[model samples]
Target: MYRVSLFPTRDLHLSDLRVALINYICAKQTGKHLIVRVEDGDKAHNIDGKDQELLDIIALFGISYSHLYYQSDNFKYHLQFASTLLDRKKAFICFCPDEKATPYDGRCEHLSPDEVLNNPNPFVIRMKTEPISDSFVIMARNKYPTYTFACAFDDMLQGVSTIIQDEAYLENSSKEELIRHAIGYDQAISYTHLPTVHESEKSVQWLLDQGYMPEAIANYLLLLSTPTPTEIFTLEEALSWFDIATISKDSVHFDMEKLGFINREHIKKLSDMELSKRIGYACENIGKLAKLYTKEVSTTLEIKQKIDVIFAKKEPLATFEAESKLLQELIFNAPYFEMFDEFQAYLLEKSNLHDEAFFKPLHFWLSGSVQGLELALMYPLIKNYLKEIVR
Candidate 1:
């Protein structure tokens, strides 16, 4: 059994990434119980609907977690631990207001519990940390021994043997280890921090604001930590791939081009039948999105119907921009390819060139894009659509 704990933040991208790692791990090691502990001590971090949504999304990826532990459920325990440390003189309730407390001040550690309780100003609990030794590691900004004292204790109590997290949190590993030592619960857990998600600056900012499909985001996260793209062959793929030892401590930038490339690969992996379903889904989604597009664009289902034919590879149509000047000139004289002879003659004349070369002129006049579905399919769809246009 391996205990894993995390503070599930609202960044769906990271949450999904962690889920993917966990699922991958379980699949690789059959029959190992993976426990999930949610760190919700900071009431400020609690989101109303997001936590459940995150759990559901993670489940969608197939990581079987044996127990879901909520740190909030143990707040009384945290307070109790605080009291123990206080009794042992290892911690104290600090009367120092947050604004006035600093590493230099150390005001809280020196105060008596009675003085702290009686003073009753805005205060918080503080650990009585030992002076910096060569052993101390800087986990984050200011200079506590790291992982905050409370976080390490919980990791011990929960028996977390390993942690797979984002690279941004690597240094926290050492600090956490140190805190475990201070509390004398000191068995070590392996740490693997994966790279951060990367995307183009503009797209990243936009995704941050508008959000993305939960499935797609989760899929993308799996891509981030998996050994290879092929590792995600099926839903079962998620449970078998977690290995904390392999995660790199580097920030993974969210690259749009890379994402587009991955999207295309994912698109290709769908079976033709699945593609048909996705085409339908895309149509529905596009219909909703049409309201946001420029009015000049057609909002009719008819256009979507025409476009989906291309996606299905049934009567695919190359965009008009793809057509060559010469092909465009040839197509300009006549519209529609009803006669096999005319279509054959056109293909024969363009035979000297590549298939893309043949479609250039025709594509230019029809779809207005340079490249897309096959000519065999596209030629007929556009011809049929144009005939409709004329009628």
Candidate 2:
């Protein structure tokens, strides 16, 4: 199993999704279990219901897991392992009062058993700096098990054979390996460190709320600095071709423009009825109108906004106000025609106005925009709703 550990301390970010995708792919590619472990051990930092929200987001992106757990649930095992390491002399109880102390001076490493028992000062459990690893706390002054301590033992206990972690945690990799080694676990654990996606204001939820489809987001994320057979694919489809080794070791930046293009492509793939529903109507005509907006926009919200402007009543520009009133009056009394050309020819003859004078104000009156989908093509679709469109 390759497990993903998420801390419920902050809002979920792109980096979290990257790691989760790697962990999920590894398990599916090997016929093993995908374990999602919420590292919510720090009670001071855990958010309310954020853990469940995180899982819901993952599901929204279509990532399924074989197992789910919380790191805090294994508190008993973490402490038990700490005592086991202390008894084996692979770890020592440190009396160092400085919580920020690092590269420890080994002052308390030699206290005799009676001296340790007689001493009343509070202390922490630190793994001995073997030739294999540096010294760090397995238990902190607050009595909470440290991340490395819990993660290392959990991997061992859960039989996790691979770990895809961030490059920032490169230093912790050896410490975790040492913890397992000192505890006599010889099973090889593969470690692949990926460069982190730097922090940004746009989070995963932010993208969703902006009307970017989940598939498009996943598609863009999986394509970042990674070569694949195609530019667009769903999370489920990516399972067939994803390879963690192909990911670039150098840090990658988020490209909003590239994601916008991918999102546009995904939007175009939607059916007419589905597209219309996104804009708050079920009629295929509205959906057709929505698709026309796709030529200039990518997200569902943008397309919906454009289509909504057609029906929202608005006054025409001052220059065209008189002509628009004439056009609206003409449309109100005019009988419905199946074709736009017939409708336009009739208006031209009745109004006795030339093409630009007639069409520009007519366009502005119908959709409240001087530039957009050509009036002729859109007229037929909005014909039945003339009473509502004419005002």
Candidate 3:
């Protein structure tokens, strides 16, 4: 049974979501168990309601966990485990000042427990690390277990066979291992260190506020994890293709352009009715416009704005020599046909001008750009615009 952990400390951010997603995908694909552990061992920094917010965000991404645990709940176990290490002489209480900036130097390693108890100074229990090792000593201060101590103890207690953590926690692996060895736990918990999601620029919430969809963010994150050329895929598709060995060790930078491209692709896949529902308004001609203009838009508001722009009259840049004749022909023939196809045929037959020159100016006048929805889809809107202006 593989057990993965999602450890959110404080307010969840894009980096936290990224870690949760990577672990969730791995555990789901392997048909293993996923555990969500709120690492609130540090009571000083723990914020109320942030834990629920993290859970809500996880649900927003459709990720589920088999078990939910909090490091703070196992305080007794952690303290008892620390006491065991102390009893075995593998750990010592440090009498260093609480405000000291220097690292613990095993100053109290030789002090007896009676001496430690007799001392009036507040002290912290520090694990005696191996000599000539880069691993830092694990500390438990004021009944609060350090990250390394709590994590190792909880993983063993919960039977976590696998630990997926951020690469920033890579250094703590040795400390955890030493704790496990001191505790005489034989089974080794496999560790997968994922690269950090760089948030030095814009944060995830900022992107969401800017109209980026959750689907786009997830797809972009999956692309960053592996070297696969496939850009657009659903979470289920990503799960089937996810392989832990294939994950890149190098840090992944955020790409806003790629996210926009993915969001546009998703927007194109929505049905006209679905688009209108998201747009939060209806127009007599919005259904047709939604299908026609969605390819160029990323958000529902953008679609609505584009539709409004299309309906609103735009002043012509320069009156063409053939403009008077074209407008007269359109006014006379537009009422004869209800469908755009027939109207288009009528315009072709009546106008002596070339198709590109005759239509390009009108297209530019209506949309202020030549590149937009096909004129056939814009026919009704264009006719309405022309009628108001011609009067």
Q: Pick the candidate with the highest TM-score.
A: 2
Tens-digit per-residue lDDT, 1-391, candidate 2 = 7888877887778888888887887788889988889998899989999999899998888788888888988999998888999999998888879744866777888889988898899989888885323578889978889988888988888888989877878888888988999988899999998878764568888988888888798888788879999998877788899988899887778888888899988887888898788769999888887777778798998887777777888775678777877888898789888998899888888888776778788887677688788887788678988768777
The estimated TM-scores of all candidates read 0.62, 0.90, 0.75
Query: Between which residue pairs do clashes occur in model 2?
Result: none
What are the per-residue Cα lDDT tens digits for candidate 1 across 120-167?
465454545566112222121221222345466666777767666656
Clashing pairs in 3: none
Output the TM-score of candidate 1.
Answer: 0.62
Question: What order do candidates take by TM-score, descending?
Answer: 2, 3, 1
lDDT leaderboard ranking: 2, 3, 1
The 0-to-1 C-alpha lDDT of every candidate, in the order given, reads 0.49, 0.83, 0.70
**Which scores greater on TM-score, model 1 or model 2?**
2
Q: Mind giving the per-residue lDDT tens digits that candidate 3 earns over 289-357?
A: 665665776655566677656555555445563664464446544564667777666766666556566
- Candidate 3 versus the native: TM-score? 0.75
